[model samples]
Target chain A: MRTVEFETIAEAVADAAIDAGRVLPEDVLAALAAAHDRETAPIAKEILERVIENARIAREHQMPLCQDCGLAVCFVRIGSEVRVAGGGIADAINEGVRRGYERGYLRKSVLNDPLKRMNTDDNTPAVIHFDIVGADELTIGYMAKGGGCENMSRTAMLTPADGRDGVIEFVVKTVRKAGGNPCPPIIVGVGIGGTLERAALLAKRTLLRRLDEHNDDADLAALEAEILDRVNALGIGPQGMGGNTTALGVHVEAFPCHIASLPVAVNIECHSHRTRRIVL
Target chain B: MTDTHILTTPLTDEHVAELRAGDRVLLSGVVYTARDAAHRRMIECLERDEPLPIPIDGQVIYYVGPTPAPPGRVIGSAGPTTSYRMDPYTQRLLALGLKATIGKGRRSQQVVEAMKRHRAVYLAAIGGAAALIASSIKECKVLAYEDLGPEAVRRLVVENFPAIVANDIYGGSVYEETTECSD
Candidate 1:
């Protein structure tokens, strides 16, 4: 059996959190450049420039990109033959999040209770999702999900009769309603088929794809491009101030669903998308 | 925008009048910070017959919940939050003579109407650009509601703080023109 130390995982998580918070991924930067170049409105172009300049300032100063440093979401894929050799997996992950937020000077946005509303102070209890695969590698993926964009996300259950056109229409309408609230030139992550929860999870997982990458499934890739086109045509543009660049990308992930159900979820992400992965 | 306007805060109606939708402005002077939690508290104080800790008349309110300042910093990343959450309280503040408010996103119809009636404007700071926004802030201090932590009301002195006039008194909104939707 392959053995991995809990503290080793913790250390990697800590470093990844801090680095991800400060730096927008390179693919995301390239997408911003393209959006700036492709934009048709003077105001949209100026907004894109400010966004690019903001990234430079955040990196140069070693500061978090936004005040909402985001809730730490860790996706862990463990090998069937591998075993964690130290503390509990959840504890290790939370400890890493606490250390990272503390050391990096990122904001502690988590509260002890959603209703009672007391401060957690250390930004603990990161949301962790685990998947098991038949391999000897343990891969940890981290995403910082800001509430502004998360609040703009939505899910809908459609009849199987609604078909592909329904999926495209719903995503476009949802983004149209979101307007400037989610901070446009946004990335739209779409999950199709599956049950309600799985569709939601898959939508979020699709967001992990690099901005330039297409879906492995050819048909799904075509759907992604079509949805991207329609959403941009809505003219929500950068910051919804109007332009031709409403969405940077649309990522769709689909699986088989029940005959009667077609579940769809749209997880919107802002331009400051930050994600990182470490393999052990 | 073909031109960038430089403005000072505690803004006058005349200053606000010069602004139009899509105009880029560099603001130098003081702005007060308030979010959902603090706005509720200020409204409560008004109901209880208490004077506001900060003035609203001829003032610009920035909707932000800033991170804590690091060892040698005046403020942490202090960018605008989504503004709609504060919409319920906005009309009240506008009625009390708030000159302008800065945030990101579309606003309620009532808010647009109030801005038109009050001769105020709605400005948008780049939403995700917190570190850059903090760089423009020269000073910051908690004015009230420190218990709210990041949501506390704070007074900030900033220079050349960049923003776009998203909604103007002339009934023009950058979002409306962009989205082509009436809401």
Candidate 2:
């Protein structure tokens, strides 16, 4: 079994968090560029240009892309043959997040409790998801998810009879209702099937996929295209001022479910999509 | 597209009167910052007949909770937050003579109606353009509610801060006017 030091993990997580805050993923940048080229509305085009320029400024100056630097989220795949030495994985990740937010001058946006509403100050503990896989390598995927878009996420359990059309309609309706609050020119992540919580997790996991990547399943890829068309038809545009470019892309992930359950979840991601991945 | 207007605060009635939906505005001068927590406190103070920390008359409130400044910088990545969360408290502030609010996204219909009744306007900054927006902010000082951390009320001096008039006193709405796709 290979052993990874907790300090090593912490340092990596810290660097990843800082990088994710300042740099828009290259694929997301490409998608925004394509959207700018196609957007006809004058306001929409201008807004897209600003978004692009904002990304560049953040990177050049090594500053957080947005003021709401977002809550830390990590998805980890631990190899069955690997072990973390010095401390638990969760604690290490949280330590990294605290240092990253402080050292990078990123905003500490987390509240200690939902109801009491006191600032956590250091932006910990991160929301971490873990999976055990049959390998010798450990991989961590990180995202700095803003509150505005997370607030717009939704989950629904549809009957098997509802099928493909139902999924498309529900997603389109959700985007329509969201308008500009979640920051349009949004990326839509959809999770189909699985249990309620799993579907939600799956939806968020789909967001980590690069915008240009297609689903391995042919039918799923086709469904993603259809949903993309319907969502852009929304006219929510950039910041909902209205235009044809409401969404930069739509990504969908699916898994098998019990005969009676067909759960679906939608996780909306804003244009400032910041994500990073590391493997050891 | 309309001509871009260069506006300075505290805004006058004439300034509010001249704006229309879709007009690009470059706002300068002083503006106050407040977000969810601070708004709640302001409304609570109003209900108690207590004075607000910042004067409302003819002032603009920017709904932003900026990151703490790194050394040598006045601020860090200041940008507009989602505005709909403030809808519940906005009308009351408008009633108190708040001239305008700068934020991102759509305001509630009630808030828009309140803007019309109060002869005010709603301006939208490009969301997520925080780093660029920070360049426009010349200075920032905490005005009140320091315990609220980022949500505290702060005074900002800005120059050529870019925004678009999303709602106007005449009931014009940029969201409605620019929509071209079918339902």
**Predicted candidate 2 versus true structure: per-residue lDDT over B1-183, tens digit per residue:** 497999999998899999999999999999999999999999999999999999899999999999889898999999999999999999999998999999988888899999999999999999999999999999999999999999999999999999999999999998784333233
Query: Candidate 2 chain A, which ten residues in sequence have the lowest lDDT sum?
Result: A169-178
lDDT of each: 0.89, 0.92
Tens digit of per-residue lDDT, candidate 1, span A1-280: 9888889888888898899989999999999998899887888888899889889988998888999888998888988998888788788889889888888888888888988877788787798889998978789889988889999899999998889999998898889889999988899999998999999999998898899999999999999999999999988888888899988999999989998899999999998898998777
Candidate 2 regions exceeding 4 Å error are B177-183
Each candidate's DockQ: 0.63, 0.62
Model 1 reaches what TM-score against the true structure? Answer: 0.96
Q: Give the worst 10-residue stretch by lDDT in candidate 1 chain A.
A: A116-125
Give a tens-digit lDDT track for model 1, residues B70-171.
Answer: 899999898999999999999999999999898999999899999999999999999998988999999999989888888889999999999999999999
| Strongest candidate by TM-score | 2
Fnat scores for every prediction:
0.65, 0.76
